[model samples]
Target chain A: MTTFQPLDIVRTSATVTTAPPAGRDVEVAKLIDVSKCIGCKACQSACLEWNDLREPVGTNLGVYDNPHDLTPNTWTLMRFTEWENPQSGNLEWLIRKDGCMHCEDPGCLKACPAPGAIVQYANCIVDFQHDACIGCGYCEKGCPFNIPRVSRIDNKAYKCSLCSDRLAIGQQPACAKACPTHAIMFGTKTEMLAQAEKNIGVLKTRGYSKAGLYNPPGVSGTHVMYVLHHADQPQLYAGLADNPSISPLVEAWKGIGKYAGMAVIGATALIGAFHYLVRGPNKVSAHDEDEAKRLAEAPK
Target chain B: MNDKAPSGAPVRVPRYSGSARINHWIMAIAFVILLLSGLSLFHPALFFLSGIFGGGAMVRWLHPWAGVVFALGFLMLFIRFLPANLPELTDFKWLAKIRYVVSGRDEFLPEVGKYNAGQKLVFWSQAALVPIMVVSGFALWTPGLDFLQSTFGIKATMDHRRLAAVVHAAAAVTTIVIWIVHVYAAIWVRGTLSAMIRGSVTGGWGWRHHRRWLKREVADGHVKSG
Candidate 1:
């Protein structure tokens, strides 16, 4: 006996289409508790010595953040931001150590005209090669934060190399080593991310409701993550720009376009030349007949 | 490709005059030098390339000057091709096939007079960018502008040098991207470099390629050296 069904579904076929799949898991970094940071310049000093960057070339203008923000010479910086809220009746000063996040999708890498000038390493650290940098300043356009500073000297791009040399030796980054308060934590991407989550949990438990993490996934995901003091509150987190992203395949896809333009342009130029070959010399240019006339009229 | 062949001597008609060629070569040399040096300086690894000009210091000093020379080359190109490159009603038609022109398949891409869409775009970009770099460049140079001092030697609002710097950077970036496409296109198409340098091309290569242009040249007059 056939069982009677209330509804019968029609037999269907599956559509199989080929497309690029999303990437697999890759490591990234986590950052400091702004409240825990005591305005110490430990990380800054460590980064400088580790990278062997020269001393500050120029002094600050007026801001308390000495040596000002990061430069071509100074890779890591402790940015001092002061906020005075009228309603809260509070004056807060925060120091954020800013440098190359070594983003999974680094803007510099996208904007670079010269291949291999700026690259991404295993852990997503934004890496730079001095020899390869053409200093065309394309990376400058690519960066959302405008991090990589171009030195006037060589026109080469400059930014934090993420202590690529140190990472190769399997040592903690210099800034982390130098931090007296353990404010700047450095470790494997997974471990650091786990640590960041725990720290944020604790901050929230301790009557600090605004404490949250700042690891927006879009910018190729960052090797450097953050546990921002006010990540939760819209008033505080609102300043952060949303959707930090980069083009995946820029010139890579343009290879086809380049060839197409060449074929047409080349054909045109050669046609002009061939015409001259068959007809004999003394052709007027595409324009400038008056000049040709002037030349003919002039005495030799 | 001479007017004075067979029964007559090969006649010379000026295509690129001596002054024009000299300007072009200088610009090209300057660009190469600056490009190599600039690349070296962009990253530390290539810093050794400082030798193209001299060294890092030399690259630094020469970069702006090279930019100035590159701009000057445009001045000459403007002097030469301004008339041919002027925007025309046909330009829009040529521009419409930009995608087809780049695709390499559309044999009937668009009939253009002298400079086609792609070449025109490149030329026009160069024209606009040259002056921009010059103006923004001066703003970037230290002591770029004199400050208007108030009563007690207090300099008033300083001009937006940073803005100029940003503009300069934007122009530089745009130029580099264009240069990449320019060079890539030059190499990608066969025998292009030969035509520009030697000033000649094959016959059939002309007809199937630039039928209109070739037809004009052959039917109207002869190719001659100045």
Candidate 2:
């Protein structure tokens, strides 16, 4: 595991660290070519082994997806979707690796309230610091992709890190290294985009005309890009969001709402102080005391 | 009716029962705790306040529990004070003369019951806001969510939690503002704090601020003995 330097962090949650690192790190990306994938769980196993995570065997729920949905222990899973091509009238089993997209403008980092709990490195790897996590699960709410899962045992959120530790030591992510067919590629984002373009060209000649790249610009494009055979209908692969962006509610809560709330609270306190300073305390007059004495003696 | 001072001084009229005072203080203490913990998480500037509760993790752990305590205490307070805080015809008159009330010109205001319009507003607003804060707070609570999922098979989705977070924060901000107003009102009205503290106010205080209440109490023979 590589220990990141403070300067490597481009953004830190709930902090005002805006100074960019003196030396810029090369932006990296993980490109998963859905067309080349064979629905093998080799990358999943490699991820589990590399991250030292042991997810309990779950009962098969009439699907090939093992362990069902993503858990805190299972950072990566291969989601298999069976699509019947209407025009071709043939069954197509579409397999996509499901994990954090690691967006350029990560929503998790935006919604995290604890200082330094979520950080985005200059290389665009969004990482979580478990010790700083408050178990609020705000990140899960902020995520457009719904990738983060908080652990029930320790109450800390866990998700795909994009293998920042491996990247730091000049090694690709474990999943990429374990890909038997080179379906999962890792390199600079520039290289991955070019590779995706070449793959799209090859796919077009092979009659998959809808093949394109899935680097959603809604989140300023993701560090994890995908070369989808039907990028126009990405959701057909398993409910993948078509135009994912941070929820406006999350944006409001973390953005203008925060500043405006503080302002309103401050104004309330200030108004109270101003009122006290101007009007002073309302004291009972001596005649009121006389009336009270007279009333108590005569009343009833 | 009044309690005579030990040195034969002015008499005091009872305003609150001992139990009522205890309940109010419990709610008040819980509100303060919730305020501090909630603020620490609300913004980065106030994050240092988390140290008071040991750290961010502890603050997260303690805030919701404090909220539960506060809600329970507030429920008791609400029941005890509801009758007193109920809107009266004179309350509208008092609200109409709110300018005079704020300017400390009480002579221009109508005689009020145990709670004036401002006090009633505080009471009712909190009554409305506390439940919202509590319900939304539970939605954002991870342990509570996990428990619901594991035990009851009730899953709160990400959108539900997100909406809850926004609602909780909005309600909390309103509650805190109302709390400040409530506290300021208590301080601004001289001798008012005694009602909650010593469970009574000077006979003059009762006659001056809540004259209608004082007259009814004396007429009903509910005065405390010296």
Best by DockQ: 2
Q: Candidate 2 at A38: error in angstroms?
A: 1.3
Q: A1-300 in candidate 1: lDDT tens per residue?
A: 011111211110010122222433245464766667887788877777776778645766877565776688778777777777554778877667777766766666655545445555445566666676655554655565557777767667788766656765676678777888877888777888788888888888976677777676777467777787677542342234455554332222122322344444456557545644544432223222333333333443
> TM-score: which candidate is best?
2
Q: Where is model 1 more than 4 Å wrong at Cα?
A: A1-28, A57-60, A153-155, A232-242, A247-300, B1-67, B73-226
Query: Per-residue CA lDDT of candidate 1, range B11-74, in tens?
Result: 2222344566677678778777766765553433455677656555456567777877877787
All candidates' chain B TM-scores are: 0.75, 0.92
Instruction: Please give the DockQ score of every candidate, comma-separated.
Output: 0.07, 0.52
Q: Write the per-residue lDDT of candidate 2 for residues B1-226, one digit (tens) a residue.
A: 2333223344678888899998989888888889999999888878888999899989988999999899999898888888888787998888888899889888788988888988899989999999899778888997667676888787888888899889999999999899999899889988899999999887778888898988888787776433
Model 2 DockQ class: medium
Error of 1 at A18 (Å): 21
Off by over 4 Å in 2: B1-8, B146-154, B224-226
Candidate 2 lDDT tens digits, A1-300? 237988998898988546777765888999999999998899999999999999987897899898798999889989999999998998999999999999988899999989999998988889999889988788999999989998888888999998888888888999999999999999999999999999999999989999999999999999999999998999998999999999999998988888889999999999999988988888876667667766776736
